[model samples]
Target: MRIRYLLLDVDGVMTDGTLYFDENGREIKGFSIYDGHGIRLLQKARIGVGIISGRSSTVVAWRAKELGIEDVHQGSRDKEAAYEMIKAKHRLQDEAVAFIGDDLIDLTLLRRVGFSIAVASAVDAVKQEVDWVTKKKGGEGAVREVIDFILSAQASHTKTPFS
Candidate 1:
């Protein structure tokens, strides 16, 4: 199936599932430049990107804003619900959506979406269930690997002006 939307899980998929706390009890996350540029390339190819994270973080909101991704759904414990809402809002079917996740919380959506991707560092169960397991670990160019696969599958990478 042709993919039109790419849904992501932030903690494990985007940030290596590591949580840091400052002295003031603020949350901190390290984002990958490779992932950011991959997202940009996906957007340039007209593929919509959305984030559905179980935890709420201002940093995530800020990152999404910086990436120009409007479909940000944070603190969504029930990611399937968020997935449904995203599908409805975008008027897309399951076959049109691809999901990348790293934990069991993402199982339902992963099994339901057309393309299911799991990071190399994902739980064993997650890796077993996914259509593809990224060679790169989360927050370490895993997202970029997935984007490259998607763009290549869609034959959009060759058409993109940027190298």
Candidate 2:
């Protein structure tokens, strides 16, 4: 099956895996423009994108909203539940989904998806389990790199809105 949906883990895959807390006890995160543009390309190619994060942050929510990602599942202690909900919501099968992760919290879902990916700086266990390990580390063009690979594999890169 082709990759119809791409699921992401927030902390490591989209960010540098660093947690920042302000003096006001609020969390902040940095997202990459390259990843954002990649997501737009994927969407233009008629692929869906979503987020499933173990930790909840408004920054993530804002970013997802900005990127037009509707299937946002944050603060999920049971990621399987989120995964199931996404599949059910979209009437998707395991073969139609792809997940990118860098930690153990994302392992079960990653293994279950059709295409599993790990960022270069991911834990050894995660890297070992994923179908592909990116050359770029998380938050440093890894997501974009993965997008290009998947689209290229499916021979759908030309379908994307951009050349």
Candidate 3:
């Protein structure tokens, strides 16, 4: 099946599942440039991307904006509802969508999408249930690996051969 849209979780799937804070108690996150570029590739390929994280963060919003992704829905306690809304908004079927999740909160949508992914360091239960597992761990370019896979599968990649 062809996946035209992708939904992702933030904490464990995008980051290393670590929450950082300074003396001032400001939350900080580190993202992979490889992942950011891969997201751009997906957009260039005309594949829609969205975020459905349980936690809300300004960092995520800023990153999504930087990547030109418009379908972000953070702090979703009921991810299924968010999934349904996004699916309905795009008038897409289950077989055309993919989801990446790394925890129990992600199981429902993971089971619902046509393709499901788990990062390498994800919980064992999550890894076991996903359709694909990344060799790279989250916050370390795992999202990039998944994007490369999808782009290759869709024959949408246009990188030059480094011969």
Candidate 4:
């Protein structure tokens, strides 16, 4: 199956699952610059990117906007619904979509996607459902690892060697 789009989870998959609040009750989530650049590269290569997170945060919206990701679905308790919306919006089949998730909540989408991914620090159950497991943990270039694989695959399909 060919992958044309990537759907990612936030929290554990993007920010190491650590939630910090400042004295003023402001949420803080850290993201890796490596992952940010990877998303930019993927966009340049014409691969669609989307974020489907369970929680809603202003930081997530800002990040998605900065990355040029138009498909941002937060506060989605039923992620499958968000997934369906993206699929239909893109007119893409399930086999052409790849999803990276880290926990049980992600299991259902993982099972449905053609290429399912788990980060190095994902739970055992989530890892078992993944087609590829990244060597890097979330918020630490795991998203970049998957992007490289997809870009490499895309490059190879076009008969261009990636060094």
TM-score of each: 0.94, 0.93, 0.93, 0.94
Model 2 error, position 81 (Å): 0.5
| Tens-place lDDT digits, model 1, residues 64-140 | 99999999999898998889999999999898888999999999999999889999999999999988899999999
| Regions of candidate 3 where Cα sits further than 4 Å from its true position | 156-163
Q: In angstroms, give how far residue 142 of model 2 lies from its true place.
A: 0.9
lDDT of 2 by residue, 12-127 (tens): 89999999999999998888999999999999989899999999999999999999999999999899999999999989899889899999988999889988999998999999
Report the lDDT tens digits of candidate 4 across residue range 1-163. Answer: 5677999999888889999899999998999899999999988987899999999999999999988999999999899999999999999898888999999999999999988999999999999878989999999999999898888877677632221
Per-residue lDDT for 1-163 in model 3, tens only? 5778988898987888999988998889988888889899998878899999999999899989988989999999999898899999998888788888899999999888888899998899999998989999988899989988888866753432100
lDDT to native, each model = 0.91, 0.90, 0.87, 0.90
Which consecutive 10 residues in model 1 have the weakest lDDT in total? 154-163
Which one wins by TM-score: 2 or 4? 4
TM-score of 3: 0.93
As a TM-score, model 4 comes out at: 0.94
**lDDT of residue 134 for candidate 3:** 93
lDDT of 1: 0.91
Candidate 3 Cα lDDT to native = 0.87
Per-candidate total of colliding backbone pairs: 0, 0, 0, 0
Residue 9 accuracy (lDDT) in model 1: 94
